[model samples]
Target chain A: MRRQNLALVMTTVAAHGPLSRAAIAGRTGLTRAAVSSLVEELNTAGLLTELGSLPSGRAGRPGRALALSERGPAGLGLEVGVGHLGACVVDLRGEVRGWLRVAADNRNRPADEVLAELATVSRRAVTEAEGTGLRPVAAVLAVPGLVGEAPGTVATAPNLGWRDVAASGLCAQGLPLEVENEANLGALAELWHGTGTSDFIHVSAAEGIGAALVVGGRLFRGARGFAGELGHVPLCPDGPVCACGARGCLEQYAGEEAVLRQAGLAAGEDAVRRLASRAREGDRCALAALERAGEALGTALAGAVNLVDPEAVVLGGAYAELGDWLLPGMRRELTARALRRWPPKALLVSGLGRRGPLLGAGMAAIRRIIEDPAELTVSRSRR
Target chain B: MRRQNLALVMTTVAAHGPLSRAAIAGRTGLTRAAVSSLVEELNTAGLLTELGSLPSGRAGRPGRALALSERGPAGLGLEVGVGHLGACVVDLRGEVRGWLRVAADNRNRPADEVLAELATVSRRAVTEAEGTGLRPVAAVLAVPGLVGEAPGTVATAPNLGWRDVAASGLCAQGLPLEVENEANLGALAELWHGTGTSDFIHVSAAEGIGAALVVGGRLFRGARGFAGELGHVPLCPDGPVCACGARGCLEQYAGEEAVLRQAGLAAGEDAVRRLASRAREGDRCALAALERAGEALGTALAGAVNLVDPEAVVLGGAYAELGDWLLPGMRRELTARALRRWPPKALLVSGLGRRGPLLGAGMAAIRRIIEDPAELTVSRSRR
Candidate 1:
């Protein structure tokens, strides 16, 4: 009961904080005494901090406003993309205190070598965060693959040539770790910081395409946690054979490699960037390539929309970079194909872009502390 | 609090009943006095009945079991299909007390005329149910189109030539009426009585394909309540143009008319029945047509499965009748196209088949009473 009340108070402040004790009591229906006690415990834990006093309308002394502390336990986010590695630290206020990104050709590379590099990057981020007086409580790693039922395992990452890789133990030492699908993390980022809808679809692209569904404000992982394989949904039953042995998958048309190939560019780290610049310069081949990819994406999304009926579709990752060129064809195809009285209201480009997964990973870890502050308080007492 | 306890007792009996009063109290965490009082009120409301005594192993007299009533406040289910109209009554025990179905080519038919016929059919069903000592509380009409947000309105049912048709007022007068999409109801019926999985896709077909999603034991209606329009999902992309003005829709390849056309059969009320018989007899053209249609259905469903990742796919409505012919092609395409490590676990034919929509409509009405028996009891007191 105490833990529950603590969580209720913590969540109340996290959601609508910068509040006085009286205001929190009124909002939570807890007595002012209970709120004060809870707030005091939270303050001692470094999870809450007093800000400037609120101005009282009457002449009485004003109560200090309380908000989530920025110097307490933070979240260390790590990512292993097919072509890059990233690490970041986010505070309880959802602000990034440390950020680092490095490009690497990780496809089919040794998982150990790649993870060693990631460990160095994460250590640097943690060091930077600690220098700023922010303590990272846990680390979350986002991978472009199916996260296994077992903790910290990536079941498969076709683009990375990784299978059954246990990522946490080898990467961020001294912190408890959790592994998540990159697309799922991106969708969570969109939910928490971007469009903020309770229901929407978020699609991201890198070497391969990935999509995630957020229904009722929660990630809708299908029964076996393999939902949102939009890249592999067959677009042309007889077109091209894909790496997954499917014919004419959406990836064959819209994935980074496919778009680069169609634009007559050699596959490399800067290929998508070059293609985007060429499209921006009104190059016919680049524009046509992106246009075709967008149409294929829209067609597959039309099917997804028909099935799940989300409120909006947010383009993220590489697609966000290329959205200006992609949106026209996608909108045309979606408008032509959607079986609705009205087209879906919004097709958005994610502001978080490629950074969504790493930030979402950080937020996810911070969220755990906020949701159950008792864990931190109990562990602190034990220490 | 009293109303909640009353609903708890009612649902407990409905789920685990033929249970004794002592069992109800133990399961519900209510005192024996509380259980007895709530049971008495439910008994007076005709929502529950005393069953034969349980065979208690202990000494002394055995307790009488309780179950949902077989009479009173039943559900009246009505459906307007493309080629037929149906009405039936389901008791709280989920037994169909009365059944009626009439053939009518409702396509392009006047909404008023068709509703008049439905009213007659519903009246007969209600009368027959009353003859069997059952009193219907409300009627739910299942239509083959999108039900509007407003009460009693259908936004569009292309197959039925219905647009903004206020069906509740025109049919089943004197009874509180609710309108639902047929596909949605079919999926609900599957959830209640068929495959019984909380997460599955239910696909039904008549002249056009319709599908519904059930997530966490509730129907997942998209933002606009237009989530499942599988018929219009593009399958061939450049094939035939659909009535919805999209090219290569799944309906062009998998709908009844499409299959019948491919089989060199005339379009009529009995076309599907004839095609099924011919395929049963191993006719080459019939088998080929059904096989092609199944493949198309499978392709569309593959996209859905990839997007939603349901545990099973229940082939309801007309597809249930043709499961033997459809399952093979669907399995083949799904296996070939799904991006999962393993294909979806189950693809079962619905036991309810074409009757799913009507039975679901009836069950939906009955569920409202089960969820909140207070409304029934309170209204009964006023009466």
Candidate 2:
């Protein structure tokens, strides 16, 4: 009970930022006494600190402002995307301390080569963060593919043309790594940091359209850790064949390659930016392509909405940058397809931008420590 | 802790009935002594009964057979379908004591008239069960409609031509009844009584295609109560218009009326049975209609499967009755559309037949009592 209270208090402060004990008690439904004790325990453990005093807003003396400490346990996050490999380290306060990203067409690259390069980058991130005396508590890798239920295996990465790759120990040292899909991590970033809304769908459109579900503030990884395969969800049924041997999938219409092709731009790193610029300049073809892509995405998402009935559909990745051009068509189909009267603002663009996955991976690692602070202390003793 | 343990023991027995204390302990990971104590408490509370002794195959001593009691704390269930109104009462042991169903075309009928008639039937069923000396613990109404997030309102029932109807108090007397969608109840029933699998989609097709999701043995109600609107999931975006104002919805291709019309049969209650017999007799038109309907249903379900990633798809209601004709097509599309290597036997037919909803509704009510037996005992003392 005490452990749970401590974790709850830490996460509450982490998510909501600096809060008075009374505010935390109100937020967590814990008594003020319990919150105070938990806050004191966390402070003693170096996971939290008091930021002098802040006005209570109520007619009373100022309350102590509690915040996550910059010292102690930190999280190391690594990502292997279709076109980039990135790494970052986040402190207990959820602030990024060190970060690195290298753009490379990873689709045709050998898995070992890319992972090894990623490992070097991840080591540098860890060492760089360590320079500030931060100890690594957890390490997580985000890959753009379907992760198997069992540990250490990337089942398939259609865009990367890789399957059954063992992905557990990509770092310089064996750090009990957790491998999750990039989109899932991105959604987690939004869930823990951006909106903090419990039930939403984060749809990330890149080379592929990947969606992740957040139900009750937790990433809803389904039966085999394959819950959110929105890209392959059939839209037109007979429209076009996909790499997964399926036809009329959402990716065929709204994915980066498809949208780029429709816009008469070569599918490359800057295609989305170019499409956005072209559309901004009132280019009819670019506008038409984006509109068509948005319509297709919205049509498929409408079906998804009818089935899942989420609070909101958060557009992420390249879609986040292009949501302004896409949302009009997307909202039309979603409104037409919804069985319930949607709230005036049901579709939202992710505020995390493209850095969401790396940040989420870091948060996920930090969350593991928060969920079990005893593990953090034990690791600290070992270090 | 004791209360949670008691509920766990009861639910374990309820899900996998007729277990010895040792078996229950093993299944629940509770110590034999703890199980024995919990069993004694439940038996003393009249919630459980021991049936002498049953021989243990590999054990030295014969273990006493423990089961849920067959008396007290009965659940009252009422269902409003597009073509039928039904009521049932089930006891502590999940045994039905009374059931009644009246077929009526409810689409054109006024909400008050239909609900009033339903109330009459429910009162009679409750009175009939009372004669057997069973006390009502909880009452649940299962409506074939989109129930809103806030309780007691049917947002829409496109098939029944109803919308925005306040449906909280339905029976003659004021019973603070809980209203749930029929499909959600059906899924709960399967989750509790069928295979007891944690994650699966229950697809019940009759006048419309209704689906419910069960994750970790609990109903996955989405952001709102309007989750699992499988009927409205667009399959062929431009195929045909749906009653929900969407084009090419699953209902247009696989709904009862659509299938019957395609089979050259007048759409009515008997059409499903007639189609089944005709298909059994090698009638090409009927076979073609069923095949098309199954394929369309599968195509949409495939998209659903891709998004939700359930362990299995359990066909219920009319679909179960017509599984032989539907399985091949449904399986083909589902298997073809899956991103993962799905288990060979991922499709299942409900064994409870059409009795699933009534059973589920009753079980749901009983579950409320089981969750808080203190309430049941308190109500009993008051009575």
The DockQ scores of all candidates, in the order shown, are 0.75, 0.70
For candidate 2, list the clashing residue pairs, or say none.
none
After TM-score superposition, the amount by which residue B212's alpha carbon in candidate 2 deviates from its true location, in angstroms, is: 0.8
**In the order shown, what is each candidate's alpha-carbon RMSD?**
2.2, 4.8
True contacts kept of each: 0.75, 0.78
Which sections of candidate 1 miss by over 4 Å?
Answer: A31-33, A55-62, A170-174, A341-345, B20-22, B29-34, B52-64, B170-174, B341-345, B380-383
Model 2's TM-score against the true structure: 0.87
What is the lDDT, from 0 to 100, of the residue B290 in candidate 1? 89
- TM-scores for every candidate against the unseen true structure: 0.96, 0.87
What candidate 2 gets wrong by more than 4 Å, as runs, is A1-67, A123-128, A148-153, A167-169, A379-383, B1-68, B123-131, B135-137, B148-155, B164-176, B379-383
Q: How well is each residue in B241-277 modelled by candidate 2, as lDDT tens digits?
A: 8878889899999988888888899866566778889
